[model samples]
Target: MTASLSQLSGRVWIYPGDPDPEAVMPCVAVVADDAGSTVVDAGQSPAHARLVQSALAEAGLPAARRLVYTHHHWDHTWGACAWEVEEIVGQESGATLLSAEARRSWSQEYLQEQVVANPRLGPSFKARARAMTGWADFAVRAPSRTFTDRLMLSGGIEVRHVGGKHAPDSTVVAVPGSGVLLLGDCFYPPPFHLREPGPAGEEIDLRQISALVAEGFDWYVDSHSPPWRPPVPE
Candidate 1:
């Protein structure tokens, strides 16, 4: 799937994720600043990352000086190496997961074995893996710095650890100046679609979300969806 850069108002731009079978690239956010661009998430592979870089270059946005992961999910963190940034930030838990995942093989046979072992993760896993034509240069790099609760970057962007049922390490990036919140799959349920009478899934915690919304953000960016304006409470 080809990703094109679209401005989400002000200093934010997004490469919306593709839902097609060819590539399930996760949406990547670029927050432009005079210093440098702060990327919310890296895409699935080096190729995907290059696509993002090309899009940014064409848009005349600042080069990505920092890469921040919303979580350690393969779709979000696998492009770390390609970003070539000195600072990669993630939650401590997510950093640990990425460190461990960095040691694993992305081979087709290995991925197939994983799918066979975990039926709940089969469909989407297979689809994402199949989308990739090659993995010769694929590498997973853990964050250079890990934060426990919150971290404030050079720009007005804030990253918070908002764990959800989807992933314990899930986090969201808030650009207060732009009123845009980049949600990294923190509102999704676990693998329940592939199973009948699936195991009870945990509820998505909404307290943090509500509080963040209360903080004056009007636009929300989900990993799989385009940016949207959620009605702000009066």
Candidate 2:
């Protein structure tokens, strides 16, 4: 499968991820300004990162000068080293978690060992492990900068931590210049390993999510899904 870059609006572009048999990639975004572009979500591997760079080059956008992660998930942040950006930023907790993961072995055997040690991680771990090939070069890169609650960057871009059941360190990016809000995976339900298998104990904070939607963004893009326009509250 291949990924193509598409314009979401002025100053905002998206490289929609392709879900192949090997790996299910995350959607990568580009927010451009006069200085340079700030890439959101790095992708699955160096190879995946290269596809994004190629798409950017084909579109005439300069290589990303900065990378902002939505969270610390492997699908979204493993490609950080390949980005070669000047600065990489993520939420404090995510950065810490990623830093911890960077110390682990990504080999298949190690991955299987993890599952064996923690049966709850079987499904999730298996899915991620199957995506590995050139494990020797596979390295997890942590964020160079970390923020606790929110951070504002050039060109009207804002990154905010919005913890969700999917991941407590989840983040949402808002590009007001383009009216596109990158939701990352904040809306996803808790992973199977974490789920209680019953009614919601603590569902995603709709108040917070609706608050974001209430801002009237034209596009709400989440990783692994098509950009959508959620109905605005009156």
Candidate 3:
């Protein structure tokens, strides 16, 4: 499933976003146009990034030249190290946060300490982290480009920093020609829970979903769930 690629609309292809029940990682999207190929988000680990790369190769598209992040969360930003993308982009705040996280060295000793220090984590969770040595040492490649508001790419992809239901640095990636909108963990099923545990994240405004119909997206994608069709307004 991780190696599959499905067409969303026109030249935009999607790597359906689904993660383990308790996991928050990249369910990525690819926009392949004449300008080149761009991966919307890098996944959670080098392994996750490999899956994306494999999918792209299978599709016969150019190597993903540009990668953009939806937010600063490790799940979406950590995988950039695995790709030889020429440009990495994100909102300024998210870029800064991700840079700090990338800069933090994660040693076996460090992971063990992090688990022990956190009162919220259980033994199994710590054990899981300890077992996954691949996640310990990797590049936390920060965005080469940062935008405060909205930025349009030369390839006709529009990235808008619409602060709503999720991280403060959250932005919407729109492939206008395809009428495809990628919602990065902004609004998901149940639509009531945070992308992460605890109260740190913001809740998406349910009322605004109806407005998405007005915006006219042929398809909608989520970070932790499958892509869905917007409800048709009567």
Candidate 4:
């Protein structure tokens, strides 16, 4: 099994997995520009966060003072507790979700139960949780900076609160300089399953996704899948 898969390019860095092979870990991104580096999203656990941090150091990118979130899912935000970042940015709705009580956001107990319930996730959970020191003192942090529409990062990357596809708080990180778009939890057929729909909750609308795909990108990175050219949205 692949322990971890990392890829680096002139524009972006992708650290796609955790130490464990079986866990459903989100792929984290780092976009580099003139000022410094911007972390696109946190990962599954503290260990994954460290892996991301190490990847940045290895790539010789500047220290990441800004950590951006694609959405407020457990796998994406849990690692926020691990990254020692100065500012966290996300959609206002995603920030609201994180501002909630840790349990309300995502309970460690609930996550443990989930790991135990799914045989596929068992090995990864054990490894990640152990690395996180028994998941002790699990915490969630609210984003220091929140945006309803679009926000620009150090590297000229734009993070937009483009929801209605997976979670209402879903976000898309697009780096025009690098020709990459990090679509968080973008379901293939456009899952349109939203949690707590509001201003950010818009329908996936396959046509729009197809349009974005057609716009062209050097790389499309997502949470669970390998980095590849995005197919015309079906």
Candidate 5:
């Protein structure tokens, strides 16, 4: 399930999922330096987490020292506990949502309702819900660290916590040195799964993401897709 670090450019290692992309969600864990590694988002299950860990070890990078949740969705945040990291960072609002026990309970219940309403999700939805059962316990410890606007991590990696567009608390991790941007669920690739309905009449904030992409990035990393790709030139 763990792929080796083949194409090395600026010490970047990508771990692809074993199953087809449709069956398995993708995650990108980037190591800024020896001191810590910044995980873009947790995978769908513990097995994916293990694959990430194995890839990190194989690449000579440290295990996920800092876990970063792109959004507050279960698919992205459930497997976070597998890392057992000390510090989990995200946007202030997202961190707040995860911090409260009531909110966590409500979110899970809401997802369950959605599954029941749409039987297409069927057993898969229930399985995912079960996987997220322990979130109340894990999410409490998650996102111990929070940022408002932007924060600079070690190794010149800058993470900007952008809101008002995506999920009320979407954090985008940008590596200025490498020009790699980790965009969580904000502007996902094709075959996008709008798991939750958008607010009333507001559309996705493509402008914000476009502006960031315009700023200049060598690679673009999304939560639901494969490895980061080269960003279009401004």
Candidate 6:
């Protein structure tokens, strides 16, 4: 899959005036073979999923063999149902969190605040919210296999279920062969707004992510950015 999509230089695909201020979420799709591929972090809508699928097809790869959620955040995981995949994988913590009724309440409140604050989103936001109301009912499945520290996949693809930084169940995928690291929301670019205030009132761990970034890779793919070459510090 990487071989086919290797020509795709990762870039930020901006969706204007989306409900969430964190509207420009990043999604990564990797084609493993003719039979399958893996899509990392399905985006906010089915349309987004279709767009991803089309891109992969255009590159002569399957839509996805499996759908892997970087975390349980709505923006990142909402479009999983749209993809044709054999299995859906997420951090164990994400599965637990998604199953709890508390997640629905929290998500609803969060979306409400985002929509109200950004009236520019208009009817499309409300429609999306209404559609997402069923997310609580959506099957939030854990990885068929769980990992604590790090797990390596068939093709030297290493996924580390590092403990929470941005969201409690965040996982980072490292393709050692290609030197590509998909950090999900753990490493947000500038103007970050996903840092919600927690119970103890601490902001999300940007430093933890910075430390993660320091480990280094030739290509750094955020759930939000197109494949990017990490910058060298002065």
Per-residue lDDT of model 5, residues 1-234, tens digit only: 446644324645555543454454556556546777777777666656666777777767766778777777656666676786768877888877766732444346766887779775655566565545344434333477888888887777677866544477777877666657777777542222434444533455677767767767677766656655554449
The local lDDT score (0 to 100) that residue 72 gets in candidate 1 is 85
Report lDDT (Cα) of residue 92, candidate 2: 92
Most TM-score-accurate candidate = 2
What would the per-residue lDDT of candidate 2 be over residues 26-73, giving only the tens digit for each residue?
789999765778999988777788889999989888778899999888
> Which of 2 and 3 is ahead in TM-score?
2
For residue 70, model 1's alpha carbon misses the true position, in angstroms, by 0.7
The candidate that achieves the highest lDDT relative to the unseen native structure: 2
Q: Between the candidate structures 2 and 6, which one is better when assessed by TM-score?
A: 2
Q: Cα deviation in Å at residue 160, candidate 6?
A: 0.7
Candidate 2 Cα outliers beyond 4 Å, as residue runs: 19-22, 199-205, 232-234
Worst 10 residues of 3 by lDDT: 186-195
**Candidate 2: pairs in clash:** none
**CA lDDT, every prediction?**
0.82, 0.83, 0.74, 0.70, 0.64, 0.59
lDDT of 6 by residue, 84-145 (tens): 67877777777777567233443456567767898644443554565453445444334555
Candidate 6 accuracy as lDDT: 0.59
| Candidates, ranked, TM-score | 2, 1, 3, 4, 5, 6
Error of 3 at 53 (Å): 0.6
lDDT per residue (tens digit) for residues 126-211 in model 4: 54454454356567777899999897766577888767656678888898777888888754333223223564454445764676
- lDDT tens readout by residue for model 1, 1-234: 666899987899998888763466789999998788999888887778899999999999999999999988878887777887869999999888888888888778888888888877777678657756678877789999899999998888899998877778999998878879898888877534433353445554567566666666768888887777878459
Order candidates by lDDT, high to low. Answer: 2, 1, 3, 4, 5, 6
Question: In candidate 6, how many Å is residue 153 off?
Answer: 1.7
- Look at candidate 3 and tell me the lDDT of residue 9: 86
| C-alpha lDDT of residue 84 in model 6 | 69
> How much lDDT does candidate 2 score?
0.83
Model 3: residues with Cα > 4 Å off, grouped in runs: 121-137, 188-203, 207-210
Candidate 5 ranges with C-alpha deviation above 4 Å: 5-8, 17-24, 101-114, 117-141, 188-204, 227-234
